[model samples]
Target: MTAVSDRRPAAADPAVAGQAAEEDLRSLFGQSTAVYASLAGPSHVVHTANPAFLATIGEERARTGVPIAEMMPELADQGFLALLDQVYRTGEPYTGRDVRIVLSPGPHAREAFFDFTYEPRRDAGGDVTGIRVIGVETTQVKHAQRLMTEHRALLEQIARQAPLTEVLDGMARCIENLAPQEVLVSVLLADPDGRHLRHGAAPSLPDFYNQAIDGIATGEGVGSCGTAAHRRQPVIVTDIATDPFWADFRHLAEQAGLAACWSTPILAVDGGLLGTFAMYHRTPRIPQETDLALARVFAGTAALAIECHHSEQARQAAEARARAAHDELARAVRAERELRAEAEQRAAAAAELAARMRAAAAAQAAKPHPERCQLGGSPGCTAPAEVKIADSWGDSAWGCLAHAEEAIISVRSVFIASEELGGLAAYLDR
Candidate 1:
């Protein structure tokens, strides 16, 4: 027997569920990391703004009761002011998603993106009065996606074993392009012993500046990259002009228009110092969270790239050595084979020479020694016979000193068989 209880969870009310979802959306894009503003009249004077809005522009320019275009004059050129005016005139709500914006101008200008809406506020008479502005800054998210794309590309380059110089140079250029403010990127590779840092890549830096810092010693107070490599950590030089680390390199830095340098040491998986990754700024400024984050991310990427390169180089070197050793061994085997053939040829020649000597001895057994240079051919040597030469097959000849020595050298196994002879050593002594 089984008993069943008739109990079930109640269904959520459509209106109440909808309201809860709306509140969460508002909290996400309105109260947190979003800009809210109220404008007055058709002229679009700034009536009020949330703290996020003030922070988004600049805290120093937090004063209200003024036109936003006047407060942020750069935005006028960027077309946001025109969009606001159109909303005020038409009384129609306008929305934009992931719109690119430049927050400031000049060399140190910052770039941003925003998803925003401009809703026309109505009066009691049903006439448009002002505009309500709500915007969520999407700069970080957009930049993060872009960074991931670029970082993945770099990893692919490493996996494919791209040249180290090409990888590093491309990385420097990519960072310079993506940084929020004007910055130059530089990479310095550490020497094998970690005693010095050599210029790896500096696409935006001046040639003179790059050359001057090439092979800089890795030690304390030796500029940003060198010091970072020496310590195997990040080194922040917010003001190159004031930092003691840049004391020696101050002149070079000034010539290159560099005011700040933040460097991170690219380390191997085993925690050994590999090289340095640096961001150079035109204006003196402290690093923000994003700036430090970028350094850490790219520093790791640089380490991966450098380690891959070293491994590839080592592999190539090993292959070359193996090829050389194989070639040498092959040559040695060929040489041994050739020597064996030559020795066999010499043995055959020796056997033939011995047979010729034996036949000549059988024919002239009684006259083994001749009187006047018997070894001469065609013309007879007039010199008196001086020595006798003989071969192993019982053949002998008597001849002048010159013919005797010549016969002994030309005929294998032929030796002096003279009863009276003066050695060359005794003759030279006399």
Candidate 2:
């Protein structure tokens, strides 16, 4: 009879045997988690694959009796098929870690990463017969790492108070880059009253498209962004071509090659609107879970940047107002000082005028007790001198009431003498 079996291993220590058993279990169960497939011949024909392989490459595309390159043409341009060719020709195992691969390769293409190994299979004759592919999908892990890195960078930018425009532009580019499918990002800042929106950032969109939508009103049926702002909620327009909200801008959307737009209103903690964040798609499509998650995350980031900018502006305005008030107060103080000085000068001049008038009256009293008019013009007055007047220079004159009153009014420093009032009082007594 033929030998049924002849396989044996050297005995090991107890600890070594236990470790070996654990390794064997790991190898069996861990490989099941991976995608496995076997290709036959130099052409790398797909002979068989597990469910994981079928799921990864698409159930419809997975088939036997076809070259792997023919089954997945997108792999040819991405250097994967070349690596396979090299492994098949050399009969050497090829292993790749975190290898990036593009699937589908078109508008609907997606990026994926795999940690995989291609081991060459050999017969009893030591001739290479086929190749075995064992791979584990690392796409989720890779994407998670990238998302964390990009998010951390954005947070750092915000913490350092970068310019709003720079932050917004970087955020837009980051979302566009991170999205699995093609998406355009737009951020529109709201007016202080939230009645209108001004363009903030739209790097991937056409200039014409951005210009056309700038200064759009925030109201119902205005557009996706406008409606979202009006309602303080998200607005998703899956098909802009048929949506009544886009009635006025259908032609514009067509020109811009946008068929769907989803907008989320960015609001402050107190419910005040800050702005709107939007995502546009070329084809009419509904948002997936991942898409909505991304929008929510970045919308909050945009809100932070916008709020910080507004706070800075408000602080600057308040500082300016304080400075202006201080200047006004200083001016008022200087004006008060000038007015007080002018009043003091007027008081001193009046005091000097009064002193000279008193001295003039005393001199006049000593000069003459005029019986008749001694204070006349060139022709002497026969009428009685009834009143006495004196000027700032102490020059005195006695004349009738009319002429004395005229002289007092005509000259700046002329005044009625105290001696004349005494004379009039004596005359009245007599």
Candidate 3:
């Protein structure tokens, strides 16, 4: 009698229906890259979850038969757990587009976006028993969009010829904000000769650290950035504390709490050194392909900025030299004009003096014998006229020794004169 029709129909059994619903949901999303999870019972224990779901919540919470809240305590504070509860009790499905959440909240937390749905699962009696979560992470899409916007802005800055330092600093900040993990971005500018690197930007690095490495030389074993620059290639130091390249800077890296550094050399189109772009991490870790790609992209940007800066400096230098040359030529022309004017004045003065001497000589021609010195001005000299001086225009004067010497030295064309004296030599002979 107890065995009579004891088995119930599969549709009537709540457990069977629940199992079928879970299978259907899994079959739809299990193989997909999209995240999928099914919670069971009023407690909303994680009954089944795909790899994407486990990865999204973190692998540490991958176990089933545990309440979602306990498995992902961080989600409770983020309001995700409450949403799950609401869907379970109200039997309503909720869909969210571009929902933002911070995973593993703390200093190491990361922001993630998702397009997701929370559909309540009903049993055979139409009673809501659990919630099924299906989600696709939009974090990369969002990050890519942001990266494009920031990259465009940087190009604009370069196009407008913003200061290199300003562009580099902004780029460092942008990369720091863009990276999913905490990263310190630094750019070092190469010297004109490419023998050393100067600090271009490091907004996230400690001031003391930045100053210490401000002008590190480019050479082998000179830390990641310097070595990268010297080799003209990328350098990846996964463990700064142990890498030979970091031997000289190990203590500094330790003090700065840096464990890893990846650097890519920025080069000009002609293969000249521009600078280095570096990403420093607090933990020792290898860089992925994506990380390398990011470095290359920004290194090119740094090159563009540095090249623009150098071109502008060269143009300014040339303009300054041209201006100086123009100024010097103008000064020379003005000086030449002034010299010609002064020469003409001297010539005119000499001509007038000659004419005055000739008039004086004509007045004195009447006297043949000596009197006082004729060249003596103001108070007359009582010395006998011992010398006769004449001008080039046949003007003659009689003077004592001192007056004759004075006249010969001061007058432009004065000379000794007499029938027996041919020049100053004849007067001296006498």
Best by lDDT: 3
Per-residue lDDT tens digits for candidate 3, residues 315-409, read: 99999999999999999999999999999999999688656655545544554757778878888888989888776466677899999998877
Off by over 4 Å in 3: 1-18, 106-108, 371-386, 390-397, 400-403, 406-430
Over 1-430, each residue of candidate 2 has an lDDT whose tens digit, in order, gives 7876654464456546544544553456444758877788988998777777877888777887899989999988789888888888888999999999888756767898999999886664567878888899999888879888998898898888898999999999999988878999999999999999999999999999999999999999998999999999999999999999999999999999999999999998788999999999999999998889889999999998898888888999999999999999999999999999999999998687566655665666776756666556788778788776666576777788766666656666565666745321111100
| Candidate 2: 10-residue stretch with minimal lDDT | 421-430
lDDT by residue for model 1 (1-430), tens: 8978775334376546534543544455555667888788977888777778888888877668998877888888889889988998888899999999988667547889999999887754568878878888999899888888888999999899889999999899889888877889999998999998888999999999999999899998899888888888899999998999999999999999999999999999999989999999988989998899999999999999999999998999999999999999999999999999999999999788656655544544455455688788788897878776666566667789898777766766675553333211111100
Candidates in order: C-alpha RMSD to true structure:
8.5, 7.2, 6.1
Clashes of each: 0, 0, 0
Of the two candidates 2 and 3, the one with more favorable lDDT, higher being better, is 3
What TM-score would every model get versus the actual structure?
A: 0.81, 0.80, 0.85
What global local distance difference test value does model 2 have?
Answer: 0.84
Candidate number that wins on TM-score, 1 or 3 = 3
**Candidate 3 Cα deviation (angstroms), residue 131:** 1.6
- Clashing residue pairs found in predicted model 1: none
